[model samples]
Target: MALASLIMLVPVVLVTSFLSGIFGMAGGLLLLWFLFLVAPASTAIAVHGIIQMVSNGSRAWLSRRYLDLKILAIVSLGLLLAMGCLFAVQYSPNKAIALMVIGLLPLLLWIPASWLTFDASRPSHAFACGLISGALTVMVGSAGPLIDLFFIRTKLDRRVVIATKATIQVVAHFTKVVFYINAALMLDAMGWTTVALCIPAAFLGAWLGKFVLDRMSDLQFRSWTRMIVTCIGFAYFVQGTSAVLSA
Candidate 1:
């Protein structure tokens, strides 16, 4: 990596971590955009996986008491299965498809959870959501919103929701890093030194975010999450549309 790119990574990760920590969303997508600007798609995806793993890990640890183990296990199993499928197929993630999927995932919130046939309370259904989410994460670099959709129906309080989701993401992102590295797709941009410098910044951001989260009411948290997700979706949608138009 160029010296400038490495230098730019710190502030980006710090801000991404704070945003993701506060709302339990959007940080990964922000990092992905920056990585795409500074690196190749594979590098962007791989680095995202690594940084997100650390960021989510910190958040998960901070809120470890509230984690739902059953859901975590079920979703993790699904993520592993999805990883195996990707490995078998030798897939290369499509950038346009990724952008479109990321853009559209938030729209799932507009649909009432009651409209879905499956029970969100069931582990099997959680697994199913995980299957889709895991696959999408590998392609898009951040499917946090999709995971959020699955949890919204469960009606957990804000802290538990954020904690459990962060824990699940730790597993999901780990899978991505392993898969991408094994496939030799992440080789060019695994800058360990750069990553090391960014880790503390990400952790600091998460801490600040948690402080903000503690002060917000459940209603406020949910409202902010939806608004943030919508804005991110529109941004990606525009980027994708522009790419298509130019092509």
Candidate 2:
């Protein structure tokens, strides 16, 4: 990457990390879009995974008191299973397909409460959530909306929701980095340095977001999260569709 492009990405990293720190959803989606503009599909996914792992890791640590270990363990088991399955198939997504999948993911947030009764508090549902969302993360580069489907209806407060989701995302993103390591290796020394610089920016953004998160009510958090994700999803879908048609 050019020096100019790398410089431009610093603020993008900070802002997206802040958003993810708050909602634990849209930031990664937005960051992935930005990355895709500058890198190949696989490389963008790998980079996004590395940055998000840091952002979510910081958020998870900040809210460690609210972490739910049991659910995380069960979900991780399902996630690992999904990863194994994908590895067996050696699945990889092209740019257009990846964009379309990510664009469509936000639709999950719009599903009516009565249509699908998924509660992440339940072991079975949580496992399913992990399996499905983990696969989506690896394949499409982001899965915030899909993960939200399992948690939105649960009785857990915003704190628990954010913390637990962040923790799970840390694991998911780490797996993504491992899966796409080869793509990331395409970057040269400067590219690697650029990525390293984004880490502290991500941590700073998450910390700042935590400050705001403490002041927001649960209702506001949930409502705003849905709205932001829906808007971003619509934009991505349009762009993806255009790309596919043009191709």
Clashes of each: 0, 0
Native-vs-model 2 lDDT?
0.89
- Estimate, for each residue in 38-66, the C-alpha lDDT of model 2 and write its tens digit: 88888999999999999999999999999
Task: Estimate, for each residue in 116-187, the C-alpha lDDT of model 1 and write its tens digit.
Answer: 644335888889878988888777777888887887666777888889889888888888888778533434
> What ranges in model 2 sit over 4 Å off?
none
Candidate 2 Cα deviation (angstroms), residue 139: 0.7
lDDT of 2 at 34: 91
User: Candidate 2, 197: how far from true, in Å?
Assistant: 0.6
Residue 246 CA displacement from its true place in model 2, Å: 0.7
Inter-residue clash pairs, candidate 2: none
What's the lDDT for residue 185 in model 1?
49
The lDDT leader among the candidates is 2
